[model samples]
Target: MTVDIEPSRAIPAHSWRRWVGLTGLLLAEAMNLLDATITTVAAPVIRADVHGSASSLQWIAATYTLPFAIALIPGGRLGDIHGRRRILLISLAGFLASSTVCAVAPSMAVLLPARAVQGVCAGLLIPQTIGLIKAMFDGAALGRALSLIGPVMGLTAVAGPVLGGVLTSADIAGLSWRVVFLANLPLGLAVLGSIRFLPEDRADRKPSIDVSGALIATAVAAALLVPAIDATIPPWARLALVAVGLIGAAGLAVHMRKTRARGRDPIVEPSLFRDRGFPAALLSSVLYFAVSTGLVFVVVLYVQEGLGASVLVASLTVLPFSLGLAVASLLAGQVLLARTGPKLMLVGVGLLGLGCAGGVVAANLAPAANLAPVPSLSPWLPVSLGLAGIGGGLVTVPFFTAALARVRPHETGSAAGLLNSVQQLGGTAGVAGLGAVYLHHTGTPGGALAIVFGTCLAIALVLAVSATAMLSSPKDVGQP
Candidate 1:
């Protein structure tokens, strides 16, 4: 009935109960992480089997992310308005059921609907994981808890490719690509056992669900995202999609203005953006991931084409990056929140820029032919990735830490939603813009990839400068 999370306490002296809660939350978060990612690898397989046009395949993937992205803020608000434990449990159950539907889907028609439902469930669970962490831990201990989050994200980011390859290759149950969807089942069930032991969190004051604001937001996001994912459409169709998004955005703005005129709570508060740090961090994330995710795409091509490695070999080579992140993410989180805060982010972003540039140089020079045995070009990719681990960890881990400190208590849901939306938008744009850059210059694919990343490196340097500007003068990062 009521959900007011007690500020998170310190990580309990190592204990089974504390560990169980941590694991449960991690598994829950992974379901979202793995699902968002793994399906992309499976998309081509589904297209081959389901006999859909390329657009349908895109829809199958976009339907999930679009809804999930559109729904995240509202989902977090729902948990706050109701109860996170109840919502989390319900979200997990719904997600599992949807996974089964996707597993058993006979055609694109059946599968796409299931993906949308699954995304909605993910939107519900993902933010609640952060909310639960907020509820359960505080101060330095909270930093530790937040730090643990990055590793699961890191694991899934790397594991998605390797795991998808294995499932597609094995086809042990004859499920082929569908095995990826079905994989969520065990992870879902496992979370149930752990969630049973999770402490319940209910807000003391429930806010009214802003249905109008939610509908508007969804329309705006889907309008923009749906078109971006469907690349084969005519130029006019593409323009139409952009127009639709602009109109939807306008409608949402007008609605919010009306709500504000009447003194009701708008889903996205204008005041939240007024803070210097909020815009600074948000813009930084947009530019950073735009380059970072694009780097992954380019590196995949560079290793296979420029370096002349097999797909399997190229995929496996990326492991060092994740392994590096798993090692350093939490430590970086501790350093950011405890010692440096904004200054830490500036350093992290700076390293990311340098590593990306160096990695580019390395990839160009170091080919598999140069290294012995397995062969590797530019061994710097892994080292670059390792350095990125610190940068990525610092930029992200402090996000929630800073959000909680700065946002009005009631707007945490919106804050979380905004965070997810920007993060996803950045990734989506990176894939599109960078992928386009690579494709448009297919005759010189390696050059295309490098150029895209080189551009991103410059942008990242600019972001680092912005962080320095915002965090130093105003003390806007820690103080509300």
Candidate 2:
């Protein structure tokens, strides 16, 4: 006689429960994304408090991303092995504790370490959100569930700088920069309570940790990020670190194949790189993210330090860019994507390059007659930033959609985890690489800003050409 078996995990059947689950997930994500850029607006203030060197400022920005990029794959695997609901709660608790630590941190020594912990917690928290969405909903529900990420992302993008500026300026009980971190507590606590409404889900197959793969990935990221902080080091030392990072990467590739051949889980599927569009899409994303993230860091500093704008004014300068990004992202997904596909991304990137050029010209044209610290220029600043924001909006959806269009259903989880990892990794690279160049020219910030923007513009041009060649073949415009 055949026996019937019931699944161990419960799936949410009611629409309201699923929506509640989604709200919790989005809330968690908003916190993470908010933390990403929020701290950036307050970086100068934090540096002043800590009396840190330029390198330390880069560390403050880049350290969070270091562990975040490294821990992502393993974190997702753990969620599958244990339970998404369980892992998410634990992660949020850790995030809350870490935020408290950050708010009370007495020194850069304390704050930086706390920020690193926060990154790992964020790494853990993010994967569970995507996993829950995938597990809870299917068909139309899944589509709607996934669609929420875009707007939430855009909303957080707009909110991060403004929130940071407000919190820092508010000086809540003279907390100043600490408010940016403290701000997370209420949202995290609320989400922790709300998560109980979500269904508990776990993978059916037994999940195993890829310890070796994780270590190698961490080492590779460390080697890549560390040298970017201390640029005064000898050329040979930097090259040696680069060599070490490349070697570690090679080892990781070999290890993944061995793991796959042994029928064990790898951090990522080695074969996913074989797709024609996958590698280019991945490269473009890294480039796209590097320029996008590095631009924010550079612009914030330029406005504050170069132009001598107050923190609040500096924050306001970024507002137009963020708004443009939201509007463009909405249009890209709702309208332009159906008609233009990857070509739209090319246009966006090109516009971003143009925007960078415009910024350079505006900064160059700053009047010497203005005794105020802030530059007296025409409307170029807002217009240029708005152009960059729109460019970001145009590229975000198409790149993600195209990258995953050919991904197999079974590999979706791994693909998503790996892509997110790359995105974080790319952000780290932007801060470390570009921030180093910016710091090196601190005495001549105008020249430094010029060089940094020039580098981004060059990368954007290359992205446009390479992406065009790869995506040239006629495909369905509405495919994504």
Candidate 3:
């Protein structure tokens, strides 16, 4: 039987506290979203200033993602065991600290480690933002609250580039690229303020961390990501990385199996997978991100290198994706509420695939070793990315909503932990796998991009098929 959560019958006297909690949630969500893209616009400036290595450049991106990926489950599990609100407060405080460290770092070594710390803080805050929503609001109120998060995230994506560009150009207080990280300080403090005044949730018996499980999961993801990244290094290293990744995954599975038999909570419980729909949705998500993340990274490189655009100009040019995502997200929620979500998903995926196809076009038509960038191709670039944004907007919330619906009410926290872990894994894997494919194929300005985007199109098509199979037919969708 399905359990539909309903709102409290009496309007609480603590409405102010509830709003405070909501604000905190929003603030935390914004930080996580901002971190994801803020670096995209800052990378060029960072490269020039640091005289960084290729590995360092990749770490600038990967450090944040890897820790975020590994720690999400543990972080979510902590929120469930301890107080989510308390964890949120701690994370906000840590985020503030990490942001400051990032702002002052003199070397790539210092900066990348600081960014990893920031990612850990983010892992704590982001999942709890949603968990607290589930704890604080229910039924129709829950629906409204979930709907509120997307537009805010969409806005952040739009701001990431613009804000990053503005900071790099302005160099006020001699900050330069530091502004990207420093900007988080005030926002985090604001969230911390809200947490102090907000409602909170706690499990009476806080569970201990599943250290063995965590080690295994971390090892597996690192092994997989490291190998894909260093694919061209050596035959022996490639084989070793793959073997290690598989062993790590196998170890985690065994550890979790033992944890389940021990009658204690594991970081990622196998029970979450019993619903069947959850794994399928997860598989589709992994495929979807293979295109989305790879496209974003590659396209940014293309616009900057091929077009000879300044940091600000490049960011502005890429604005279409964020804008389209925001617009699509706002509209898709309302459409999905009426039983038409499947159609919108199809349309969104179609648009997204078309957008990836456009990237292929952009790459092929790029000026060849020319003195000037082709002005003609530049204008259409955003249009192509914007299409994917629209599709992304439609898919994100509904997919999460659908996935969460498949779990039992008591298990929401566990489900949240698991799903976020998988989401980050897909993102990390996308960059590693598709990125390697790109680097292997071409050495020109847009060469890596053309190959990466083609891979993206193929991945998108696979996701489209999966989404259609699951959502188009009544039999596959079942209840959730």
Predicted structure 3: lDDT? 0.71
Query: Residue-wise lDDT of candidate 1 within 363-428, one digit each (tens)?
Result: 455533422324445567677766765566666655545544666654555665777777766665
- Among the numbered candidates, top lDDT falls to 2
CA-lDDT, candidates in order: 0.68, 0.79, 0.71
Considering lDDT, where higher is better, how would the candidates rank from best to worst?
A: 2, 3, 1
RMSD of 1: 4.6
Candidate 3: which stretches are off by over 4 Å?
1-14, 134-142, 230-232, 336-339, 369-378, 439-443, 469-480
> What is every candidate's alpha-carbon RMSD to the true fold?
4.6, 3.6, 3.5
Query: Could you tell me the C-alpha RMSD of candidate 3 in Å?
Result: 3.5
The residue ranges of model 1 lying beyond 4 angstroms of the native Cα positions read: 1-22, 40-61, 104-110, 130-151, 166-171, 198-201, 301-311, 334-339, 362-390, 399-405, 408-410, 469-473, 476-480
**Candidate 1 lDDT (Cα, whole model)?**
0.68
Worst-scoring 10-residue span by lDDT in model 2? 1-10
